[model samples]
Target chain A: MSNVIEVKNLTKSYKEIKALNDLSFEVTEGEILGLLGPNGSGKSTTINCILSLLKYDEGSITVFGKDMKPDSYDIKAKLGVVFQDVAVFDELTVYENIDYFCGLYIKDKATRKKYVEEAIDLVSLSEFKKFYPKKLSGGLLRRLNIACGIAHKPKLIFLDEPTVAVDPQSRNSILEGIMKLRDMGATIVYTTHYMEEVEMICDRVIIIDKGHVLASGTTDELKRLAKIDEKIIVEANSFDSKYIEEIKSFKAVHSADYKERVLTVSYKEGADNLVKIIEYLKKNHIKYSRVYSERPTLNDVFLELTGKELRD
Target chain B: MFVHNFKYSLKALFRNKTLIFWTLMFPIILGTFFKMAFSNVTSSEAFKAINFAVVEDDNFKNDEVFVTVIKELSDEDGDNRIFDTTYVENEDEAKELLVDGKIDGYLVMPDKKDDTPGVTFINNGINQTIIKNVVEEIALNEKIGNEIGETIVKDEMAKGNFNIDIDGIYEKVMEKMSDETNLLDKSANKLDYSMIEFYTLIAMTCIYGGMLSIASINNSLANISQKGKRVSVAPTRKLVTVLSSLLASYVIQLVGLALLFVYTIFALNIDYGDNIAKVILLGAVGSLAGLAMGLFVGTVFKAGENAKTGILIAITMFFCNFAGMFGITMKYITDTKMPWLTKINPVGLITDGLYALYYYNTTDRFSADIINLIILTLVLTAVSFFSIRRRRYDSI
Candidate 1:
């Protein structure tokens, strides 16, 4: 696949603080490129700089094989952006808001109408098409905001935390809609702090922190960067600290902690780690209500790379 | 793109209830209150017949021209019944009537050959001034008539014609003089001082249009609103968006002005003079100045929408107060004391323009006001354009 967007040595500053520093990445054609970072980690800033919405101190950005500038209308025409904040007119209804934003790029009335309807359907806002923005709920308003941004069906779309405060159902619906967009053969740059969202939808992931790209790969590949290969949790009525020390003594055990009657153990690398822990629990006569083991998530990898939680 | 932006802009502004109230309904409500407050004032301030008495002595009776003039003026059936006169037999009787406050003053006929007619009043006021001015005018006209009659008589005698009808010539001269004075009085009566309140009301309405433009323009600035960021990211030119938004605002402003004119004219019985077209023209241009000012405030201020709105209100009210929206005396004081302020104030220019159209015979002052308003509009528009033409910002 060819690159739809290219960034090299992107640097931005706000007075004394650097918002982006020597950041470089490429968005391949027809794929979902997740920009994952914690709060204040320059995710939105990077997207803005790529879209030419912000002036960078030093770097070059290209969208669709052309240098991006504020007046790059041809590139801008094929780009759609859903900002973090809902940006729809309070005076307009859901349908009208979508139509208005779409009208900016699509001049044909018939085409705009069709596209606006399709957007409403994609966001599942067909029942509330006539409702004004103020009358919609938070999730519905977020859906409307998304519809307004992508109504024109651009070749490249930028979605910045579209489900920040949304409920699970709405978040699932939004994620599904984004996947459909990606399936429609359009390139998408999705930015979020939620690692699950990036893991579920993004074909490729770029983890950034402190204005620098920490790691970039598929979710499984990035997960390998974690120091531990597996994590185990056991809920028990009573757990002894001595057993946690014994679990720590295991050759594959990286770390073990017991807090609030829950024992969590990290394994460096091993197969049947859960079976081994279960056997040890049975032999020790420790009555555990639950025991489970899971592979390292992107958060673990981010924690390993940044020395802090991804949510931090 | 322009049409699309303009269409949605109109819808957005029209649906904004706060903007509708401030720009359209607020002005109408204020204008109604003004009409209610000034209704009695206008009626009370209208010209009324002066009450006075004349001491009917031999000289008063013998002065046929003066007696005829006074009788014609005091005639209730005449069109120019300027005086409600009661003749007294002697000076003492006239003095009693004046002291009784039944008459504004009493006119005494020339007591001696070298004496002239004089008016006496207990207190000096508008009525007293009117009586004094009328008496003095009659005296001046009589003197001029006498001179003219004498000149004609002398010229006729010089030409060796002794059959000169002096009485006929004097009567004709007096008749002509009275006719001209009556015409001047009629023209002077057309000056409606209370109309200043209405003129200022119109000016206030025009300036209030700035509120609409401020609200509209604020929606198009990326730093000020979320919608602005969406618009800025679009492929369309910023100038088209800004201009289309302003055009929508301008149209709404004109609609508000039209409603005001209609309500004031038909409902409040306010007369904006015969030049209704010029009044509408001045109102339109003044609204343009208002829109330009709003654009300037929206683009130049880094404050939020509410803060910018408050600033615009302060500006509009300042200009309105200086132009005498609150009271006409302020307008008079400002015009005389700070003529330069009036020249620079857009509201003052609009008010003065309407004043000129209502009161003046020529359009010189009105034309000057319109030109000044246009210049102000252009300057504000240029500055606002410069302020908003930037495609990118340091921060948003």
Candidate 2:
């Protein structure tokens, strides 16, 4: 297997907090992997471990089939990172800044120049080439940051919350740019709280909670694993508890509840499930004002697995 | 690694205009201040004139030649005068002048008592300075005349004709006197090598250069050192990043010093003499020492920017200022009364060496200074290497 990054039983802790507990994962060549986790669920910690930025209590990590040390320049040269916080030189103009960081990996002046221009074009920062970070707006700065990071054209890229706090337009542009990078053969390790972003871009997703991997698979596959398949809510002026018992008799009806003048029904999928619920409600003469249904989402899965209490 | 690190570092440093201002232009501004202070005329107008009261007998006061010299000596000029000279009618008048605070001195040319001449100077809580000095010097001149007369007479008697060799005896006496003095005087004017004073100044340059190095390195480390931790996941090594930052700092120091030297040498009319090349070379070494110091601080301090900037500044100031190495070896040049500090300051060593070359052209003070500077650079370099290598980006 051509693995760009690999981790085996990696455990990392800070003080008393076990940030990563026996975490093991790997990224295959040219695959964009989404690392999904709630805050303090050790998403960043795992990335740090994979990058060898943090020393784990157990397990080992290898990048490009070599033992990584702090001074692993060869590995570092092929790696590009855009941190959650914008990291770009404020003093340098956009072009100069890109050239400077790009020059580190590519020695040839002509090649460096070409890569820099390409990066500028990629991020659509050509017009702001001469502007410093201060001169650019928040969105422009974020784009410039991406350009600086990817201009070096590292084989592997780690983007942590790249779209956080950006305007929707810039965020959309950034996401497109990231997809283009993946299309161009750059493997990406992305982390974010936004589920749609993962679903939209990630080839596969890894869901971690409390320093351990809760689930990992394609988004659809992960959704299939969730016990809570669907939810149904009926708002009404009045309802009887006896109707819940009758609704439970229907096929595939796992549970039914009638409380606070409204009857709520949740169940696994089955043929004619909605039709049976309506017939039961009608026979019982429960006047419903509103009704709604939703399939299992990543947010539901996260809320169920990690609990809704704030981590920090 | 070299160019990459240098480029990034340069980019980073230019972001801080405050640091650049203090490190680069401040010194030249200070030098300009000194230039203005030393070059402009120091008006004696600030000081009160010394009052002179001469109790001369009528014999000398009536003499035209003596009166002319007196007038020439105690003269007043445009808005400023050396002394307020008063002619007293008698000793009582002179005493009254002294009592009234009207005069600083009194000179009484008494009647000739000894075979020579006598000049009695009196003062009531006042000094008889100028006139007393003149009278005594006149007496000494007479004594010199007597000696020269005796010599001439003795030589004429010995020789059939009056011809004597002055050069031979004068040369011997001058040589003997020179030998008795300290060696500091040996190359006072010769630029054969760097002088001790020059070495002290070069050391001072290192001290000031260290300011930017420390500031930039610490600022980068504290703010984004963690960024390295994040970057470590890539194909890049932390050391390369560090080296690039250091290289950038070195370039900054070079630029700052070059600007200063250019302005000082060309614009401000500072003379580096034939030692221009030597100054540049020594300056490069000084820049290295400064960068080494910066790297050391950056690596050693893992806390926030406040702590880093504070500690770096403290270290730079302590080492540079304490050694009298930064500017003219302050103690050695101005003879500032800082005994212990000037002795051990390492920055002093580099600056003193360069200063000697640039100014006095004496090399005696240079060897020790160069040795000291080399040792300091090595020590700082070692510190930078060890600290940066061992320090983790997240370690506080």
Candidate 3:
């Protein structure tokens, strides 16, 4: 698929702080590209610059083969953005809010009504269509905010932490709905701090930190970038520390430890690494209750790429 | 898109309880307080006939013309009657009645040749002072007429004209003086000065339109509100959103002004002005100016929302008070001491425009005020528009 959005050498600064530095990326069509980062990792700033809602110091952004600008209505008409903060008129009802926002791009009343109804159903807000924003719960308000942003059926959609502060139920529903949107042939750029969300739906993920792209690829591809290939855990009683030291001497074994009747080992790269560990436990006469092996996850890759520092 | 934006803005603003309260209900309530406070003031109601005590001494009984004039003034059946007078037997009796507050003051007959029928009063309050001035004016005119009649009669005698009617000449002179003065026991409409308060109240109501302008600014700028950011990112142009919201606010403010005008005239029975069309036109223009002033303040001050609101209110009250909303002579003071202020201040121009329309016979002054008010409205609107039009924030 051809790239729908091409951002090259995007740089933005606020006073003395650099928000985005020499950031370059492209989003392919018909794919969910997750822009994953911790809080204050320039995810929102990058999305804003891409949407032309903000000005960048040195960069060029192209959407649908055209340069994006403040007056780029043609490009903006086919774009939808759901900001991190819920943004809907408090005075308007759910249906009216959706309809009013949808009317901005789709002027035809008949078409707008059809689209508004579809959007309401998409977000499952039919029961609360007549409710004001203040009357709705946090989850419902977030849903309503999403409905307002996507009611116009824009081809390119940018969702900035749409599921923040939402309950698990609403988060699942929102994730499912986003997948459905991508299935309907809309290119989406979803930004979030949660690693599970990126692994769940994103076809390709970009892990960013400090205004720089640390790693970008499929979830499995990102996981492959980790130093450890797999983690092996054995719940054994009285496991010998001598065996732990022996396991650490193996070429494939990155590290091994025995604590609290559990023997755990990390491997660098070995398809039979788990089998070898289990054989060793049996040979050493270690009584094991449960034995399990797990593959490296996106969280490990994220932590390895971006240090574990507290960000506000 | 503009129409759509305008429609939603109207729906949203109309439902705002705070906006409605400040724009409509607050003015009506304040107007009620004004009516209750000024209910008994003399200028608030029609002028009533003054009560007087005339001493009936020997000098008073000898003056037939004075007695006829007093009788005519004391008669209740004639429109020429103004004084409710009672005849007392002596100066002590008149003085006793004046001290007892039974009458405004007592009229003493001229005891000396050049006294000119002098009068005295117990207190110089509005009612007592008005009665004293009226009695003294009548007595002085009668004296002058008598002196003129005597002079003319002496000239006639010197020419050997003995057929001249002395009483007729004196009566003719007095009648001419009464006709010219137009204050001789004649019931005429008094100019109500209390209307100035009501005009200032209206000026205040228009200035309260700052609330709408504040709303407009909050709605248009992205830094202040989330709705602003949402609209700014939409496919529609930013200017369209600003203009549409402003138009909606202008329409609501104009309606608010009309309701206040009608309420003051019909419900409160306040005399606004004779020309209804001119008043409405001036009110519309004044409301526009007020709206512009609010917009300018809201745009110029990038402070917090509450701080901006307080600033708008403080500025508006400052202008209204200077225009004499609290004191009637404040406008006069501003006009005299700071004459240039009345010409430039929007509230000053609004109240002065209404004042001119109320009192001045020619539309020249009223037209000038309206023109100045329109120019002020345009200038404020332009300044605020240009100041806020292409504002691209460094950060939102």
Candidate number achieving the greatest TM-score relative to the actual structure: 1
Number of the top-ranking candidate, with DockQ as the measure: 1
TM-score of each: 0.80, 0.68, 0.75
* Residue B33 alpha-carbon offset, candidate 1, angstroms: 1.7
- Per-residue lDDT of B236-351 in model 3, one digit per residue for the tens? 98888888988888888888888888888889998865677898888888888878888888787778657877887888788888887787657656765697888888888888
Best by lDDT: 1
List each candidate's DockQ score: 0.56, 0.27, 0.37
- Candidate 1 chain B weakest ten by summed lDDT: B179-188
Q: Write the per-residue lDDT of candidate 1 for residues B164-219, one digit (tens) a residue.
A: 88677777776766543432332325544567777877887787788778877876
Sort by TM-score, best first: what order? Answer: 1, 3, 2
Cα error, residue B126 of model 2, in Å, equals 25
User: Which residues of candidate 1, in runs, are more than 4 Å off?
Assistant: A237-246, A258-261, A279-287, A309-312, B40-194
What are the per-residue Cα lDDT tens digits for candidate 2 across A1-312? Answer: 399988788787788888889888888889889988888888877766565565678888898988766567788788887877776666778998788667767888899999999999999998989998899999998898788788988889988888888898998899999999999999999998888888889998888887888888888988887666676778887666666677778777667777886666767774556666677677767789887776877776767677778777
Candidate 2 vs candidate 3: which has greater DockQ?
3
Docking class of 3: acceptable
Best-first order by DockQ: 1, 3, 2
lDDT of 1 at B58: 94
On DockQ, the stronger of 1 and 3 is 1
